[model samples]
Target: MSETRPLLEVSHVSRVIDGKTILDDVSLSLERGDLKVVIGPSGGGKSTLLQCVNFLQVPDSGDVFLDGQSAREMSRRNICEFRQKIGMIFQDFNLFDHLCARDNVAIALQKVKGQKKALARQRAMAELERVGLADKAALYPSQLSGGQKQRVSLARALAMDPMAMLLDEPTSALDPELIGEVLNVIAQLSLSGMTMLMATHQIGFARHLTKEIIFMEAGRVVEAGPPKILEPGGGGRAAEFCAKLAQVTGR
Candidate 1:
């Protein structure tokens, strides 16, 4: 990896789903230890862009580069390896109903990384503790609150020791009161210097932590700059959009 290159870069990426253009030539980059937030109206390509970056939904055009290596050029085996280093957190906590929180976090370690069961469980516990979920490790997802389940999802991602994380509306599914717990963990990760690209509607929280805000609309990046760009009287599309959002959400 070249020191000068971005830790992650999406170059001219586009995605077409069912004859609709979801992302149109979107480009962005994240440097090591940086946190970038994507904020836009619903159906504005925020989630799709994050999915394309992780190759969960492959881009129809352009490419994603990790550590200066092109994702489109990697072999099948290498792609799997590459994905393991980029953690993903989704709006829905994708936990197995049958598995306890610990097992949910440990499964990938055993299945994908081929670690021994005991060691995986140990690491899973440590990650859970990091996310302040150690007490809930033995609980099933059905027994946990929305915030706890999301924290388990965060613990699962952190267990992988990813170089970068892509989060897509991670708090969207939570109740109004539950949102703060998940956001607290995310803020801690940012403070700890974890590189992240997050798509979220929590404009206030994002403005406080993000190094830059990328505003997208209609499948294109409309504006991107420091958080000040979204401030009152900053005079840009991002500022106008955020002002409207604050009015709607009353936050």
Candidate 2:
């Protein structure tokens, strides 16, 4: 791919379930190393859009390209290869409760990449350290707080050394007091230049973190641009929504 071209290119994307549209003709271009945040109301297709980028949920019609290669044309094996380079974070912190945090992170590297046990554990430890949870590495998810579990989840994703990360409302499930910690870790990732496409309810977080913001509603992108573009009298529903959110959030 040309250096000038975007790292991800999504065009005319749409999804439907039982004839009800979930995503409607959405399109975006993400340059390499860009940090993007998507914001909208609940059930506004933000999660669905991230899934399409991660290749976890295919759109009924549209094109998703990674580094200029069409994801649609890739074989299952190729898709798996593509996915290994892309990390995903979920709102629920879907850790395996039965396993220790370290082991949870190690499983994917060992099973998916066939890494040796010794190496995998080492990698897990490094990732956990990065997320500021090295001391809790041996603790099971059941033993950790919601914020700690989310940190471990992020460590697991970072362990894979992914080219990009897709985060779906990752802080939504945390208690209000605990939310800042997880967001701090993500903020560090952004500063380190980890490409990310995040769906979040935190408009202030979006304004501070993202280079550009994408606004989705019902099933489509109503607007996308730098934060300054969302000023009052911006002339779009997306900007109006953001204005309202800013007022509510008191940002």
Candidate 3:
């Protein structure tokens, strides 16, 4: 892959749930090494779009291509292959309750890459340290703060060394004051040039973090452009959405 080739592409994609259209003819292209932020109101299917890209939720129609190959055409084995290149972080830290943070990060590496226990443990600890949680590696999810747990979740995602990351409202479940710590980790990732697509309402931080902003409504992307072009009060529904988000972000 050349630096300029799109890392992912989507064309005329649609999805439905119980006859209700969730996405309709959505089209998008993601450039390699670009950070893209997706923003939308509640029920707008922003998360669903990410799910489709990961093949967690299949689309009803149209195509999604990663590295120019249609995700829709990929077999189950190939879908797993594709997912290895993508990492996802959810709003709720999905760490296993019975497992400690280190185990949480190690299990995926063991299962996915078939690495031996000693190697996986070493990698997991390194991942934890990167997220500022080296000492907490032995602690279970029940023993950690929400922000700490989310950081562990980030570590688990990063342990895979994915080609791209998809984050779905990563800080939505935290207290207002705690949100910054999680966002700070993400900010560092952005500064490190991680290719990412994040769905979030943190407008001020997002504008500063991402190269482009994508606005979706009713399962369809309605606008996409440089962050400066879509700042609060720029215009249209996207502007209105940004304006509301800005009030929360204190912009």
Candidate 4:
């Protein structure tokens, strides 16, 4: 007999760097198509958790399971394979200034996936179109606004055909006027059944789109529940952050 498990699971994961604990016994689970938001104050380990999940930062101790396979057991090469299944979109956009938007998205497919240049270019254009940037494909990073650059970064991740995505402050670096466009793309991904673990301060988006909201503090997962946990007067630091975000966004 066989039993199926969650698409992603972080169990009792802990990480300490230079005598400071960045993540302490944190755990999370995501079934396929689950969109979970993680929000907290600065230094709360939200970003670190996503890093560990992607294996960009190995935890000091613990296990991460992607689609029921133990990441802990992967060798260096295996770990690389594991990460290809988990896409990461950064706050900084991280696009190469010399690379046009289409190349920025296609380079990974050509280099890592070993696709021919022509095929990679075709797929890259399709992903750019998905993010509403097909026309901008010929543009370079310096020619694009902050939001457009971020969408190009997102397109790069999608071209990898990831099983799930890890987003670290996806819109935090955008201009106030530009944040909505990036959020709209992310909101569509949620509606289209993309499994994602997002660390963000976008409380309004959390309220409407996330299936679960996780709040971390001092490296610990202090609270995790449905969006109702952020209701007025809801107890704890998570609620405090939610309230403050609501006030700032006028939600």
Q: Compare the candidates by lDDT and give the number of the best one.
A: 1
| lDDT at residue 107 of model 2 (Cα atoms) | 94
- Candidate 4 per-residue C-alpha lDDT over 1-251 given as tens digits, one digit per residue, 9 for 90 to 100: 11358899999999999999999999999988899999899889988899999789999999999988899999999999899999899989899889999999999899889999999999999999999999999999999999999999999999999999999999999998999999999999888989999999888877799879999999999999999888888886778887887787787
CA displacement after TM-score superposition, residue 2 of candidate 1 (Å): 2.7
After superposing candidate 4 on the true structure, give the runs of residues whose Cα lies further than 4 Å from its correct spot.
1-4, 247-249
Q: Can you tell me which runs of candidate 2 are displaced by over 4 Å?
A: 232-235, 246-250
- Clash tally, candidates in order: 0, 0, 0, 0
Query: Which has the higher TM-score value, candidate number 3 or candidate number 4?
Result: 4
lDDT of 3 by residue, 176-205 (tens): 888998999999987887878899988778
lDDT tens digits, residue span 1-251, model 1:
37789999999999999999999999999999999999998999999999899888899999999999899998889889989999999899888899999999999999999999999999999999999999989999999999999999999998999999999899999999999999999999999989999999999999999889999999999999999999989899999998998888987
TM-score, model 4 to reference: 0.96
lDDT of 3: 0.87
Backbone clash total for model 3 is 0
Q: What lDDT would each prediction earn against the true structure?
A: 0.94, 0.89, 0.87, 0.92
Screening candidate 2 with a backbone cut-off below 3 angstroms (N, C-alpha, C), the clashing residue pairs are none
